[model samples]
Target: MTAPSPACREDVRRTLAYLTAVGYGGTAMEVWQWLYRPSRAWSLEEVMVALDAQVAEAKVDVMQGRYALAGHGARMADRHERYLSSDKKMQSARWFLRVMRLIPGVRAVAVCNSLSHEMASEKSDIDLFVITRSRALWCVRFFALLPLSLLRRRPGHRTRHPICLSFFLSDASLDLRDVHLKPDDPHMAHWLLSTVPMIDDGVFADCIHANAWARELFPNAQSPRVAWYRRLACLRPLSWSLPFWLERVLEQFQLERLPSEIRTRMNGSTDVIINEHMLKFHTNDRRLEYRERFLSLARVQK
Candidate 1:
């Protein structure tokens, strides 16, 4: 391979540093796919050559075909173990999506966070981003939580591979830039890019179109590859056609029953948003923390 240009080498190092901060590594193709170059797209051969140059300079390490920071080569082993755990969690997520599909108003369901990145640990609960019909947000949340609560598969009930129904948005409100942490939020940008849709009734494309800002952060990143099993469709419509008044009734009922913690935190900020368009119940958001860590690591490499 020809010697990589200085700009290509810097881009490769920054990408590896970001991944290292997130507790994982990547293969050559993975590096190219996740490459952090907002200005221009780089070819796979360019990224590979840059990675090879970094390895030669003792700035990066490769193990079993995976690349990491110089002293973080062990992350490849951890990543492999987490990949196995992620496979099992994905199987469980698929089963849960089948059940969710039976409910009304569910427009799209995508796996997010660690699981979407294929880096979930054994204890990591499955995190999902759901999209419901406009004005049916609260009603859909009620039904979606009902079955999981009864089966003891929710976060507090199930210790291993539990499901976390934290974030939800209505189809009318697909742009997520408002919920981001102000000026520059790298984590949220990557999160939006990483979501893997399990059940999409044409809403996934709309959602992506709504958040085109993510392309500015990762110009070369493509939409996540949809698995064959995740292509299931909701053939028969059910109670989704209910009147708007009933939706308001269900919304009030669910609001009253919300846990005290969520009630107190509701609408306080983006971390625990609660309204008609979106229902995000994350009491402990870590986007700021991850952003800081990534910046710190990237600066050190520079």
Candidate 2:
């Protein structure tokens, strides 16, 4: 119950900031450079600076390691390490998206959170905002991915908004096969029609180019407004069921399209949503006991 040291607190802040900021799942030194030389370019010397007394005090949770990239430049870097630079992240994301797109069964990917690679905190897992080409495939991906390394919510946050890849594919309320248009869900069609090149089989370059344009032109576009609002409300962890049920009810018209395999998972998810609705309707005064325990006086002081 003792308070965290001031240096530890600063380290915690820096760690959170750096993980999201850099986001390449790097070794210790790579993260160090991003934090220290946040504004200016960094040399390996910046990495060494962290070894100093006060500076070292600011990296209590960071793993200790010597810099192998001491020679020079970004590519002379270690083979095994994954360092996420701003450009690198985009390139990496586009690569995966293109790969997913090319996969035979995958119709189109309705990207969500993982594309941007939200800042990862300690114990934070990756979240992929995905939409499968088909409901059978969606079910396959869901079950295939159920055991994968993933986390829904950030540690210390009560929301069950997991960091794992979650789907908003084939609206359970709509038919699965109908929504996607050869990787184009309206906007994607616009992208293919306008920005993407009709290159050889490798539409990778085309996708990258189109994605850039989409990001630039309609940067804020996500899902439709009502659906998005319901999604936002449902993932909040507590009292999630009500909005979830309402969302299902709104979307139920598409149920005829739901595949039998995906139907199983959908049923479970629907029930959870219904539970949340019931909780919201029935519980007059819901006091979450864990919130108080999770935020002790020591944590506040720290």
Candidate 3:
């Protein structure tokens, strides 16, 4: 194959460095999709050629269809095996989506963070990004958490399989800047780009459109491939009214106890914020800290 041009080589270099910084071992296809491009004009064949050149130059390693830094062959292999095992976890997320959608006003459900990027460990909770209808955010959360809480009570149940419903927003609150907490956060940009939408229902598509500013920060980033199974949650006829009344009833009697219950049961931090349009539970602000670590490593690689 002909050698890649200087620009193409730099693109490949940055892509490898970024993925390595995040401890990602990606397939050729993943590398292409995740390539740092202002425009996704590169074909898979072109990406493969560039990867081949990197492997030949000993700048990248390839093992079992996964690619990473040269000395990370074992790590690459392990990541691939974990990715193979990720199917079960993905299915768990899919099943959770099926149940979550039944809750009134739930518009979209997407898996986010590490698992969405196929780098999940055994102890990772199924982190979900839920979009609800306007004005029904808290009510929907009340309903979505009910069955999930019951499922958690089963004997020998694992926390990893349980839904971690920490982030929720109404259709009107999709900008995400309020929760971002920092300007130009690469992790947040990647999170928005990498989220795997399981249930689109037109809401996620709108959500993506509403958050198009992330593209300015992560030009190479693209929407993750939609999940194959688009089956939405089936709702009982009374599901809508149930949550409406439940939210009001809880507000009357259980409101005072709800915070403590959430803390004990969810292991959530005291920083939980509940409002009409958004719910954020990140008491430990780690986005800037984590970004600094990644930037530190990326700088060293330079």
Residue-level lDDT tens digits of model 1 in 129-222 = 9988898887778888898888899998846889999998999989988888877777788888888887777788899889888777777777
Query: How does each model score on lDDT?
Result: 0.83, 0.30, 0.67
The residue pairs that clash in candidate 3, if any, are: 37-220
Model 3, range 1-302, lDDT digits (tens) per residue?
A: 77766666666666666666667767888777677543446677777888898899887888888887677666765675566556567766666666675667777777887778777777666778887777676677767777777778221366656567777887877887665645556667677888877766667777777878777655656667654453342221222434456556654453465666455534343245566677766554466765675566546545
Using lDDT as the measure, the top candidate is 1
In terms of TM-score, how similar is model 2 to the real structure? 0.27
Cand. 3 Cα-lDDT? 0.67
lDDT string, candidate 2, 47-140, tens digits: 3443333234443223223221111113223222322332233333343344343433333343222223222332333334332222333332
State residue 244's C-alpha deviation in candidate 2, in Å: 26
lDDT of 1: 0.83
Quote each prediction's TM-score: 0.93, 0.27, 0.79
- Models sorted by lDDT, best on top: 1, 3, 2
Q: After superposition, how far is residue 268 of candidate 3 from its true place, in Å?
A: 15
